[model samples]
Target: MIIRSATSDDVDAIWELNRQIGQYHFENVPDVFVAPSHLDREFLLAAIMDEHRLFSVAVDEERIVGFISARMDINENIPFVIKRPLCRIGSVVVDEDHRAKGVGKKLMEHCSSWANSNEAYQIRLEVMSFNSKAKSFYESLGFKPQSEIWAK
Candidate 1:
């Protein structure tokens, strides 16, 4: 599988990936977060530009099977208390039909290497706490829970 930088041509595919993943979250936890119509969002736009680091299309035989997007952290978020330049995994998605075939793992492995070498000390991401499958998936990949917030 080839992991390469994303370009304008890959936007639609990336958008589709985000849509599928977003909808999956909405269906799983419809009461808290409603999925948005994901067209023309700034976040998506940034992914296609040089402003953020983007890796797309784990391709084989000229077809994209999966993608990953990541960038440097830029907010006062989370309890990691990291005051240095850190990298964040923005989003990573593999086509449902292509999952469990080591595609996602490759994308992540590449992204993690890229981030660590580029001055990102800690790789952090926020997942919906209710998504046990995602939480478990992350944990199996070595992501431990640092903190938790309960909402009433």
Candidate 2:
């Protein structure tokens, strides 16, 4: 497995990987995740060019198998509190066949290196409450629950 920076050529594969994750979330929480559509492609393209964003892909035999995208987030919307920058994992997805083979871990290690170099104090991501597998994967990486969002 080769982990490297994402290029324009990888966009289509990345989009497909992203769609799989979106489908999973939509299946698990339709209220929070919309069905995958062309609009997501535009959103991802913008993310690729955004200065605060970092995108990487994992390739095997010249095929893109996984990708991770993160952005530096400073909580500017909240007032009256000292704000610290966070490295927020926007999306991290590995192909179903390639999972459990360390692809995700390599992607995250790259993200952590980028975050630390950028002076981000924390790395954060949100997993749907119903996705126990994802929550467990994150927990194994030293992530703990900071808060929960409850809905009726």
List TM-scores for all candidates, in order.
0.82, 0.92
Q: After superposing candidate 2, which stretches have Cα over 4 Å from the reference?
A: 77-80
Task: Report how far residue 85 has shifted in candidate 2, in Å.
Answer: 2.2
lDDT of 2 by residue, 1-152 (tens): 88888877677898899899889888888987899999998888777777668998999999999999998878888798559988989888999889888899899999999999989999989888888888888999999998888998
Per-model lDDT: 0.76, 0.88
lDDT of 1 by residue, 1-152 (tens): 78887777777777777778888888887877578575535567676686557566687666677888777875477667656777777777888788878888888888888887887778877788777766877887998987787877
Residue 127 of model 2 has an lDDT of: 83
Clashing pairs in 1: none
Summing lDDT over every window of 10 consecutive residues in candidate 2, give the lowest-scoring window.
Answer: 43-52
In terms of lDDT, model 1 sits at 0.76
Highest lDDT against the true fold, candidate: 2
